[model samples]
Target: MAFEQPLDRTAPSISEAIDHERGRQESTLGMIASENHVSESVLEAQGSVLTNKYAEGYPGGRYYGGCQHVDTVEELAIEHAKDLFGMDHANVQPHSGTQANMGVYFSVLEPGDRILSLSLSHGGHLSHGHDVNFSGQLYDVEQYEVDPETGYIDYDAVASHALEVDPDIVVSGSSAYPREFDYERINEIADDVDAYHLADIAHVTGLIAAGVHASPAEHADFVTGSTHKTIRAGRGGFIMCDTEHADDIDSAIFPGAQGGPLMHNVAGKAVGFAEAQTSEFESYAEQVVANATRLAERFTERGLALVSGGTDKHLLLVDLRDSHPGLTGKQAEAALNDVGIIVNKNTVPGETRSPMVTSGIRVGTPALTTRSFEEAEMGIVADLIVDVLDTPDDDAVHDRVTSTVDDLCEEFPIYE
Candidate 1:
């Protein structure tokens, strides 16, 4: 294998781009709600020689040769995931979170099965049932939205809609929602309609694992999550189900939805899951919520309207329609980027703008918290973000914010 060779010598372009990305991450403040920094141990495992192997089947059952070592890695990942999330079975082979959802859908659903999920504009994910995604193209999808006045999902409304639709499956999760979900209530609703409950905890997997946020494992029939975002695991996905559906879920992932598993990334997941069990990780998760709370408080005090008013987890959805009328989320994102702060524009409840140019920005604290940022630092970052949004055209403000961001980045280096 040429795996031991240096990338700079053989693929300079790719190596240069990788270097640039590291530099960018080290220099800027990453506030994107769905992003986080993984540990160096995870980085090493993901970049290991296992990437050169082909692990086409689950542990102790292989369709290919030389899978013995990789099988150990996969088994460790599976066991750790099962222990971490308290699920009876785990399939850590889905290439991404979307594929994880696809695997679960393929296992139990036929074409055109009805799906009831949260609306995309109101903080739901594309994989839940968006028209453009395969989930929607293959399923009959109906959406539920948050209350326009309170900016929170009304459980009564969800139950009413579920009764009317009688869906085959009820999805409980979101991408930009700022409040905790009532998973028990949703599971009960699914029961009333005789529908399966699938909980996609991709964005809050780490928080749930650390016990900072409530877990959906006991309430939902199926659970799916991303390995990278909040978990700092790696760049892959996993599915959790009861033993009754374990074999079905594994086969769905292997032959039904995907091919060979990314064994190296599975190794990363194994390493990250081990790290996440530490007491420090619990405190880190707690600080993440605290920082987000402080940031939301500062935003509200500065007159920025927050969807759901504040956050109960790691992220906030700021609806800019009232505070900065005529200014689009795209503009706010660019202005913040100019000041060395990174965030993504998102659609809020009752969104009127197109997906390309949304009316809100989704900010989070997991990445900053990984860098050891606390409530005081989050307050400062919030002020900087609001200042940029308040005066996007002020050159002096840009320069000042840029300098402060540089100073903060230097003080809290991501990789010592």
Candidate 2:
């Protein structure tokens, strides 16, 4: 059975845009490394009547009335999160990954405090300490970068800098960078400096959930993630800390960063977390990585230069400077978008180009794999991606690529 209730009667333009976006997804390839398609169940929970409630405080300690049922939803989300990540405490609010980081900082640091994190251009996220963001604006921020040669995090360099800067919190985790971080090593440096290690696993939440990527729960003093990314939950953020700092985290999240929690999204988180606990989700996560590996191998075989040479998780960064000299990341992005294969322009390490017009493209497999695409399908898609880039302006190549993308999207329908 389907929900036959119509949206046009209530909101024509909004409903039209929603329908158009759905049709867009149904036709194009979603290759953006930071994106994924959520399950219909998750979508339903997010769209539930729970959205009409007010839940201002934690489970029982409510700042508002009529929160009993919403309390249950939030408790389930928190407990499921604790179990999923093996943490002593979980705050399922914060609105987004940046807000989650904000909560952590509020719990620990004062303004003007020193913060050490990866550079945004070198795979770090804005919330970590980009100057335009509050993290950089309020705090004294410094950054560590990938080894310009290997395109990997320079561990020794980070340790040396951490020791010298003695930052209040050393944040680890990134939006790009294809390799893994030695959390234990970073943990040691944080300990030596008597600083807290805030591991923002916003990108690898699903991999960590599936045990494919190492969990930072044991190593970092604070761990934050986006529920939407690899986790495929609602668009929200979370923070996990030990019980010793649980109250601080909860306080920082509520009165500090956000007001009433989005109960519907909290319900959605509970649903997604339950889904993640199953064996099927574990298999799905593993397959996501496998598909990425296949795509990386294909790209390598086709002579494209990959950041860190390849991927160990669900995403990879392709540096196009060597493979396609004149074609900037912006150009490649526009060309791929025209042909129905969606991807984002990214900046590689030692990038000289402007952020808006970078020299690389970041691609991932989580979305396609969620569409039930296997290694074989990934190979074909990878070939098509290379084909578009090889002849971006050729009308015939664009037509062929668009046709193949449509066929694949039809074969692996998302929400129909």
Q: Which candidate leads in TM-score? A: 1
Report the lDDT of model 1 for residue 185.
Answer: 97
lDDT, residue 196, model 2: 93
Each prediction's TM-score versus the true structure = 0.99, 0.98
Residue 356 of candidate 2: its Cα lDDT? 98
Write model 1 residue lDDT over 295-377, tens digit each, in one string: 99999999999998999999999999999997899999999999999999999898999988999999999999999999899
The regions of model 2 sitting more than 4 angstroms off are: 1-6
**What's the residue-level lDDT of 135 in candidate 2?**
97
What Cα-based lDDT does every candidate model obtain?
0.94, 0.91
